[model samples]
Target: MNTQLMPSVSVEDITRAHLRLKGIVLDSPLQYSHRLSEIYGANIYLKREDLQEVRSYKIRGAYNNMSLLSDAQRAQGVVCASAGNHSQGMALACAKMGVRGTIFMPSVTPQQKVKKAKAFGKEFVEVVLVGDTYDDAYAEAIKAAETNGWTFVHPFDDLNTIAGQGTVGLEIYSAANFPIHKVVMAIGGGGLSAGVGSFFKALSPETEIIGVEPKGAPSMYESLRAGKIVNLEKIDSFVDGAAVRQVGKINFPIVQEVVKEVILVPEGQVCATMLDLYNEDGIVAEPAGCLSVAALAKLGDIRGQNIVCVIGGGNNDIARTSEIQERALLWAGLKHYFIVEFPQRAGALRDFLHVLGPDDDITHFEYTKKHNRAVGPALVGIQLSDPATYDDTMKRMAESGFKTRAINKDSTLFEMFI
Candidate 1:
């Protein structure tokens, strides 16, 4: 338990970073959500840090670290690897600072991200897609750092990096005329939470800090429970930006002391928030960015406290937008898929189709031929305006002498295959 590694970053460092970043970064919105305030029983403020220059708060840290580079180091350039937002941040920062930078990213990264990264870097930086995952890309970045002697700009877990991210805390405190009673954020690699938590601890120690994570990627929460950073054997990568297998060595201790709770929100719940923020607030929130706001649905009671939620990043893959919408619909009970096990004898498909009203439509249909025939399973996905239609549909199904079971049902187990 060496506390030396986690030396608390001061509010002074954060304020200084904010001052330095003034002309470089835009002041992202701090919108007051009256609807949210009434619903959550707290005076909620959405610190729209996602609206920053690179469309993420990552730029604050990237710029801070880059600014610290000596004139000599700037000549040689900076290098690091990121999934997307950090690359965007580093690319734009280096370009603006008149420094050369190289970024390595996941090979599976969407073409849009690649295009945007290249757009940000322009001629000032080089973008490379190296490996299937961040860990792989990072290894290559480290090698590049060693060989070229470039200043390796880590996305997190560095003194300069953490100090840079603390600018958010400075912004929060500066924007708050009233003392903030609570603050919430989504934690991925822990840099944002570390920097923000440390700054708040120094400046507003009484404010309760909460961190949220996708339930499928609750690495931080699980690790905190175990009292150490441990690798998860499996992780769901739906929330690609915030899904992490282990906590950062540098950030874990910093957060543990300051954060009051770590909430593991359901993936479906996150999608719901994404849609709500978009539909109600007209805020385009990526999965990772909507996490803290998503926690409001689960947090049943909070009467009159001023709360701030850091909307992290907005580097969403435009192509995945449909899937995000679908997930939201499924979570809202407006979409469902079921495997109807029926006799393979006659016009069963037509009969099932006729049972539905005009509003219900079949979204997917798959029938697997049997080699060792007993019966057949027809995988069907249905979309409807009303979820209650399922009950009536099932009731009619039973009376028609046909059996139906939801793919998600215990006996069906069809959803598990995918």
Candidate 2:
């Protein structure tokens, strides 16, 4: 592997990509996040592709790939599968080009994403909701393509699509005349990385392109190290947008050539990042959308580097904000749930409440006594705004003579007891 022989990551390619996608995609804002920059010792510039028309960097790839289609192929229409972004990208591109399209999404996808996919198509494409995971939908899309004679438009893993995604690098380099030392982004199918990394590699060869993935779903991370696409047996769908079983074929090659480092973020950390974006910046960032910001907590230190973190997408379904917040608490170790063993006496519950710290609030409480009401246990959830407060709260509970068992990270018992 001669690092110098193949110029997959180069400036010329990135510049060409910028020229290619100039009028097609928005420049997307590159703004400084004061709060984040202060927290993580670095010059943090958030590439807000989340504000793009389709609320993601996906449009760049979809449009680039679809635009290269011959007139005859465009008439034949294109088909693709995505949990959200890519579908919307194809929809918008298809509508603009008057090319009919069929998009397949997993059944578990949120209603908001489905709606966005619909709006992006604007009558130029047909949305087909299918399967339970991105892999399932991708498989279904491939199957349907054969019967309908539609060209399967992969979300990543295509040359033109990579070129389209490369546009981001083009915009960033042009907008920031100064050198950017580092770039970080979330990788799903890897098209965004392939394209963006390729461009950055060419333009700013010294700039590092870091890809972040949820620890629960490390398909791309594993694939990159393995030097080929690899499959994960399981992935937590909490970050539903980016949880993928395998990396894209075409996307992997580009990543191998251009990516500098890959980082894995905990799902809970992603949740915390989302909340930070919302509470501090007044921006609602979905779990996958918060990947780059999530990097600040994991990337050891970078005091002086000019860094850019891509806010990949912002299609946050308002309905799930509460759950996101809850997850954030658990991840931050500020919330704990306990199943207390106590005698079912009059002062039992009262005594427990008195032990809670001043800032601790009872978020959830449930109890059940066996056939005998005189003795049993109760399951309680304590939500502390600050994790530091838990120690005092526990010390008080022990002093008050209350015996309890904690189960915060145990998913199995959490579902059954709390």
Backbone N/Cα/C clashes per model: 0, 7
Give the per-residue lDDT digits (tens) of candidate 2, residues 1-418: 6655542534554456567677778899899878777877778998999888888888988887887788888888789989888888899899888999999998888789899899978889888888778998999899888988889888876777777788887778778866798888998878777777877766578999999999999998898788777999888877877889998776777788888878999988898888878888987777888898898767777887788998989888888877887888888888899877777778777877898877679988887676675567778888886888888888887788778878876789887864
Kindly report which residue stretches of model 2 are placed more than 4 angstroms away from their true locations once superposed. Answer: 1-20, 395-403
Model 2 TM-score?
0.93
lDDT agreement of model 2 with the native: 0.82
> Residue-wise lDDT of candidate 1 within 1-418, one digit each (tens)?
6777665777778778888798988777788998899887789999997788677888898999888889989998899888777788899888898889999988877666678878988899898888666666888999998999898998886767888888888788888899898889988878888888898888789988889999988888988999998778777777866776776787888888878888888887788888788888888777889899998766556788788988987777778877787777777777777767767767778777875756888878888876556568777777876887778776776776656666644534744732
How far residue 223's Cα lies from its native spot in candidate 2, in Å, is: 2.0
Query: Judged by lDDT, which candidate is best?
Result: 2
What's each prediction's TM-score?
A: 0.90, 0.93
**Candidate 1: pairs in clash:** none
Q: Candidate 1: misplaced stretches above 4 Å?
A: 1-5, 341-346, 354-359, 367-376, 384-399, 403-405, 409-418
- What does the lDDT read for residue 40 in candidate 2? 73
